[model samples]
Target: MDLHEVCDLIVDCEHKTAPTQAEGYPSIRTPNIGRGYFLLDGVNRVSEETYRSWTRRAEPKPGDLIMAREAPVGNVAMVPAGLRPCLGQRTLLIRPMRSKVFPRYLAYLLIGDQIQNIIHAMTNGVTVPHLNMKDVRSLPLPPLPPLPTQRKIAAILSAYDDLIENNLRRIKILEEMAQNLYREWFVKFRFPGWEKARFVDSPLGKIPEEWEVTTINKVTSYINRGVTPKYDASASSLVVNQKCIRDRKLNLSLARQHKSRVMDDKYVVFGDILINSTGVGTLGRVAQVYEDLNDVTVDTHVSIVRPSNGDGIDFLGLALIDLEPHFESLGAGATGQTELRRDRIGETEIVLPPVKMRKQFSEKVTSLRKLVLNLAARNETLRRTRDLLLPKLISGEVDVSELDIAIPEEAA
Candidate 1:
């Protein structure tokens, strides 16, 4: 545990490359919901030309640890496959001084919440924070024992990360299925019926005789835009920022709840869909507030929609997600960060089947949504458990001598 005597491995994480797409440059973005090692913050994918543009881009080797160091700080991910090629912005890449330790072990050290406090100390500027090579060199790290011990800890944590990634992968598949269904049945006008399907006029523009166009307001009477504080309460409300909508799930883990104004049950309720009205490339992303959330409220940047007594609330969530193509087309305007006309939320035009069919769709989607949520929740829990286990095992705090995790061949 005496880390002071050990020489710390250090490298300046690269500034992210330009946003423009180039033939050689493919981008790497933080995975959704901080679910996998691939995620640190919002997703980023850069073209090869742009990846080369960063003055300090560091090519991580396999087993190297990558940490997001600025703007949004302390998100950590590992380079499992070894560094083939990756470019990052405001991140630190630590190449393990293998003579003394395993790179994976060092990665676990950087991720521990306790060590992050140490990492934060090295950033020079508070407003626009950054860490140079010198700063990274000075980063305090605990001296870990041997590779086997380090492997033990890394294994414990990696278990969670691995499971979380699995869940994310599953969700992606399911959501893709849902989206494809939407496109086929709704967009492409493909249905079980036939080639002779008839069209009819309805409230929501022209639609199939069996379909009806409707406004969301008719779906929910209690819906309205979210509340913003007259007085800022950094302590109280983490207004459901657009970032909260990810992985086709709403993550309020980052939402800060502060006290400013009164919040009623009406302001937020379970199954209530919070629509992101603003954010770069996130305009109109809908988050379904599933069970397990406390009394959380969103901000003006998002609009809250509640289903009517007869409407299938969960169905609405699916419908919105399925209609993402439509929402993207409508477009939002923002000078800097993207902002959309949220007031038109209830007014969004949607085509649906007859009342009975709509109800059936709602029920099926609700059931499927619950299954996805449960699986996702389980995945998150597993990943969290593993994340908690990593540092202790890696740091030699919680012993894991009995856990039989094979060391990578190169690591050995």
Candidate 2:
């Protein structure tokens, strides 16, 4: 089947509008408000004010094609429902006649390498690359399948998304539980024998009788800083940096390679937690090195901790990640850019429980983290399969109609 270029399907498109209801009015300044993204995937929401400011004249519905046009282009995302009227100045809205193409299918087609390459080509500018709308519509769109088939493919992909979303929600619950426990036991002084508890004057002020206030350095036998010699494309080493840690987990999807670095057995493995002792935004961010951690090389921004005989890695990691906001405030200097120094991080104190309590806490949090890791691994696999199948289905490289999406018998 011949691919149908977007140019042929055009019913209408609009760009220029009356400045203050026609008749020249003073130009109103439009702020980006960090509310712009072109090649976005899996973004859930945006601010109502930003949405209103974007779509003052008209509101866009869900399933509309949104393309970034200004300040460097090649960004796209489906306009989700329940959004206040939002418009994009540097973005293009490609609405297909439903009689011709399914909007969701078209949105699916624009993901992965095909759209990535297209965006790269459309980018034009020195400082900031802007996308040309003329070239955007000129780009070819594949001949689409019938409505039922389009919906089927979408359903198959959506199933994977549903599972992934559920797993994300589960992870959130696990983190919250851990934090709530910490707050009750530590901050609110709600141990089993709180009324009978006695305070001790340790290095960390007034900790409970059962608690030992100690610096994190004592909990770990080896505290070392990692390095990346240089960035290299061909190298196979997984180089982790400050940005790799997000929401208390290590995101290895964005993991890159270093030229060459020291490779060792103690490098990174299951349940190893790394802390960002100092950086602009990532100071105090904690990353647990699990799943796909092999031959991993880290950089200076990270501080690696190997738990001593008394502590468990998972317990400490969860604790650190849970208290990241507090750690950031304590470590950060009131300046233009926030930073947490390595020495200052050591100076900052935390109340430590006994070995038995540490292990018990680790058992709960690690089980949760383990569940997250397993789910994450599955999500990664699903993502890769979906990405691989996406282009094939869109470009007609594979017959999507012939594909079988096997739902369980009960589900069916």
Candidate 3:
């Protein structure tokens, strides 16, 4: 059956322009759609009044599948319950015919390679490819299994997703705890025995009398950008890009495989800090490598900062977070692409607490950091398992009917 046959309503957002963040309701755009989840952060907002006015014909409801129609073409995410989001331009809302098709089932089908390939072929655009609504509605959908089987498949996939989501939440909490401690001690100067610590003036600002103000160059043993990756289909090495660093975390999803000859010196190792060195909005972003990434290297746009001695990784990350504004100010460009001045970054002065104190702070957060890394690794494994199972289950190649898989109570 064509998608239009199984879907009750297939509509794109109204062509009307959405208001800026200051004057809008929570609006979702192409970038807001991840593989199977909606990324709320950095999503634009539209006025509630405007949303109601434009969505009069078809309002986005919980369980409706939202797919990017342009600038990306096939990314899909389901609207969660209780979100009255205004569908932004270049996005499509799909309401499945509940009796014949489950919403989650349809969402999973859309992301499967078969449907994705069909959508990709029908997409048309010169610089930025897009899917035409007419073409999308006519796109052929594979024959679906019985509703019970559909539910079972969705339940199994969602279980993995739920575990991954739970781990992500825990990782976020752990990260916040570590960062808060860093701020309280290093930024707010509220470390233990703070009452007796004397104050001293430095080039950057007033800091503890015992702290030394130093440039990043003084603490780092080596600093250099990686080579421009030569992408090879057969390559086993992964190359990190600017997009890989988000919210001070490394997202391997953004990394791509490269065929270039391996250079041991160019490899980003555990404890190495990566900084996006080019492009506006992405420049100056930093993330520490907490895991042992084998055969992984970064592209030229990313600068690798290795601590002189092995202990400054956490301190440098926190310092960079605090001095992000300073780094942003040093960005030089006019064509919407800003490049960070490497010299300025090296010369950026930061307050350095005593070695013993820094070590103490690291020890305090060491377990928290370990937890974050462990959770991230677990999520990666879960993701691989889901991806491996998805196509087989969706294509009916693997039958779950006889399997003794138990669905979570909430999911059931």
Candidate 4:
């Protein structure tokens, strides 16, 4: 069946960008559209008036699927309850016909590999792939089973998603806990025995007398940008690029394989901090390695900042992570030519606590970061399991009719 037949409404977004403001309804752009859920963090907001004007054609509601039509072309995410999001550029709103197809089921099916490949194949553009509205409307879908079966399948997928979402929330909380700890101890000078500690004027500001202000180069054993990689699909070594570092987290899934062998020092390790070292928008983004990586290195656009010692491994990463905004300000050159130079990064100032305090901070922060890594690994496993099951369930190759599955209300 054609996508249009299963959907009651398929509306295109405003051709131009919406005017964004400090607050109002969120504008759901292509970047905010994840595989099956909206990635709302840092999403643009518009004034209520602009929201009304932009959504005049069709306002996105809960259960509606928003699919990217360009600049990625096929990524889709469903609007959840409580979000009043308006469509942004190169996005289309999909309203599935509830009686014919389950909304969540259709969303999962569209993001399935089969439909995603079909979407990419139908795209048109020399540099950036895009989908024409006509092609999108006429996109073929696999034969759907009965509505009950569709709900059952969606419920099974949703279970995985629900767990993943829960872990995501916990990860966010854990990250905040670590950040708050850093701010309290380092920034706010509220560390243990801080009240009775002597203060002195320093380059960064007044600090505990025992603490010292030091440059990144003085503390790190190595600080350098990676080499330009020769990409190869068959290669065993994965190279991290600017895209792999975001929101203080390293997503290795975005890393690509490199054809050539890298030097021993070039390989990323468990405590190393990876910073996006090139491009205007992405420059200065930082992420620390939480798990042991094998055959993984970084590209020229990323810099590896390895701590000098293991005693305060988390301290240096957390400090660098906190300096993300400052690093962004340090980008050199104009617009697209901007780069985070190795020298500038090395010269960046950071406050160093006493060895005892450093180790204490490491002990606390490492525990929280370890939890984040574990949760992330669990999410990876859930995603893999769900992805493996997605196509079969969508294509009806794996029967759900015989199984007694309790479908949730959201799936209904």
Give the per-residue lDDT of model 4 (tens digit) for 268-369: 898999999888879989999888889899998999999999887878888899999999999998879998999999999889998899899988888888
In the range 84-170, model 3's lDDT, one tens digit per residue, is: 887888998898898898788788899888998888777644567888888889889988998778888888899888899999899
Cα lDDT of model 2 by residue, 232-267, tens digit: 889887778876776677887667787765747337
Q: Model 2: which ten-residue window has the lowest total lDDT?
A: 25-34
Query: Looking at candidate 4, what is the lDDT of residue 225?
Result: 81
Q: Residue 209 in candidate 1 has what lDDT?
A: 80
Q: Give residue 341's error in model 1 in angstroms.
A: 3.3
Task: Identify the superior model by TM-score, candidate 3 or candidate 4.
Answer: 4
- TM-scores of all predicted structures: 0.82, 0.75, 0.91, 0.97
Q: Best by lDDT, which number? A: 4
Roughly what TM-score does model 1 have, to 2 decimal places? 0.82
Can you list the residue pairs that collide in candidate 4?
none
Residue 126 local lDDT, model 1: 74
Query: Mind sharing the TM-score for model 4?
Result: 0.97
Candidate 1 lDDT, 259-278, residue by residue in tens: 64646843577778777776
Q: Which residue segments of model 4 deviate by more than 4 Å? A: none
